[model samples]
Target: MNSIFLKAVRNIKTLQYFPTNVVRACGATKSLHTTNVRNDLMEFFDIKKNWNETNIRVGRAWKLDELRIKSNTDLHKLWYVLLKERNMLLTMEQECYEKMNLFPNPERIDKVKESMDNIEKVIRERNIAYYQLETGETGERPVEDVVNLVGLQEKYEKKEYHIPRFMNTRWVQSYLDHGLFNSMAIKKFYRLYREKQHNEERKARNRDMNHVIQLIKRFPDMDMEKLKAEYPNVDIEKAKRSRKSRGHYVPKY
Candidate 1:
């Protein structure tokens, strides 16, 4: 298994998975060392150990803090390493499932995914910082609230284009010629959608009010502070004053 790890690591440079341009973009130079890989299907299938064994050993997933400390080049390499590991784990799992065998330590998949996610987070942080320093803005895609064709407000992620919307004939034709937004059906849909949303909000408010009243009635000496914390919208004092909140018990004077 250890030898397999080395083989996979060595094979990464030769597999053409990381193109020269991409590696250079990561500020990584080509590794001086080179070794031959079998270049076989076993690369994906048999890389992971303990496929049939109950006791398996592997290191913990990469933590966000740990990954953040590593250089971009190291992260670039680690990302691909995790990517290959993930691919092998999925392939092994599928083969095991098809063969009616239980996959050992399915949590390995989650570990790889978490590591990849952390690495991405670190990369994104570095990117945003670099962009802010260099260009006075985060390099992430610009997003804004935009009304869709259906009249509902939604997030619109802007895309790069060679021409502006008004100048783009295809875009202009599709949006301007098709008066979908002005149709009676669309207005009716927008009206009904807004009404449905408002109705749900109202029902939820009433339900919370009724539930608070019940709690007040049942547990007269209950922890009102905790109840208030849980349902911040419920008016505890108002619920206490409500007729339904009065207990159905006669006090022994």
Candidate 2:
């Protein structure tokens, strides 16, 4: 009877210890699982509250000075956040436009664009700095100023060539040959272009001057400041001094 009682007591102790160990193990497992879930959620998306807001008031763009201070990882995270915000704003604006409603503030798009641009600029600056430190080069795309076939100077981005410059007959003929620029056809085209531009300018000047003349003729006491404001380029003082501006009545001098 004594041996049986001792055996029963040992079994009961083992059973009680088993529950305590199991509870501790379960608690540890739950802690590990909760940590993993929190990290996974953080990596997946932004905070939830911004999901359903009619108007999200965000501050201005990240200025270059502000961006310059951020570390690479911080800047990378910021870039994605701004990108998602831009996409969201664009989607909302499109929906609003589709409904034929006015977008409350179209400047929001401009602000987002400015932010993205600043981000890109910051990245580019860092890249250039890294490149220069390691390789002594700005690491930027090369460009050159060249005269086109029409004899107009233009900025051209330079690209690699399989053959040397002297060996490229086609490029040489197109770019170096003065005959292309001095051709009769090109000259005629340029002349016509200039004449068209001149005609447009003349028409605009006459139209504005005539409008000013009518205003002056109708309102002899028209304020010179107001006239100047209305037609900034029209030399108001010269127009007033013109014989056309004189009234029919004799001079009061």
Candidate 3:
């Protein structure tokens, strides 16, 4: 009889706890149903309401002057915002192409890019100014005129490398003997290149001379000073002696 009473009390306790557990579970489910699920990445996209629209209007990019007034901290934060906006716009554009739908306001991407470019420009200006003030030099890479392997001049930006100049086999080979540019074949090619350049210049000069002659033939009373100003390279007196410059009605000086 005592064992039966103990069993009955245990059942009573289970009955009491069972309802509370069920109620707690039910409340948890209800809370879950009421809660909102957020996706941060999708925030890069425009709002859902505008997603299917054919056209989405947006304002112009951030101007340089406007950015100039902003503090560096604010500009830094704004850069991220513009970057995110650009990424979102690109994503949307790609999706639109994939779906065969038109990307609304394609210029929005341009605006974002322009804004980012302006931000970079402002930052560079600040960096340059800071460097000038502190070190009497701009923080930008220094560029100098360098003769390339083919005997052409190029603007070379000086860069620092871990290796020494002598260790760079490729550079030494290109600039020194046994290189293509140092070979007889390259010398012939360079000669031909110079000839071609000379031929083009000669042709251009002849064409200009002929054109000036025609102008003189057509307008006999044209201002010689103006003609000289326009075609300073042409020998106007020499062109006047040409048979073409003697127009049908003109013996007029």
Q: What is the TM-score of each candidate against the true structure?
A: 0.68, 0.52, 0.59
The C-alpha stretches of model 3 lying farther than 4 A from their native spots are 1-39, 148-152, 183-253
Best to worst by TM-score, what's the order?
1, 3, 2
Predictions: Cα RMSD each:
11.5, 10.1, 12.8
Order of the predicted models by lDDT, top scorer first? 3, 1, 2
TM-score of candidate 3 relative to the true fold: 0.59
Q: What value does the lDDT take at residue 167 in candidate 3?
A: 88
Clashing residue pairs found in predicted model 1: none
Model 1: residues >4 Å from true position, as ranges?
1-38, 46-49, 53-61, 104-107, 199-218, 241-253
Best by lDDT: 3
Q: Candidate 3: global Cα-lDDT?
A: 0.86
Clash pairs (backbone) in predicted model 3: none
| Model 3: residue 89 alpha-carbon error in angstroms | 0.9
Instruction: Determine which window of 10 residues in candidate 1 has minimal summed lDDT.
Output: 25-34
Residue 166, model 1: Cα distance from true site in angstroms: 1.5
The local distance difference test score of model 2 is: 0.76
Candidate 3 residues 122-219, lDDT tens each?
99999999999999999899999987767666899999998988888877877774576667877887899899999999999999999999998998
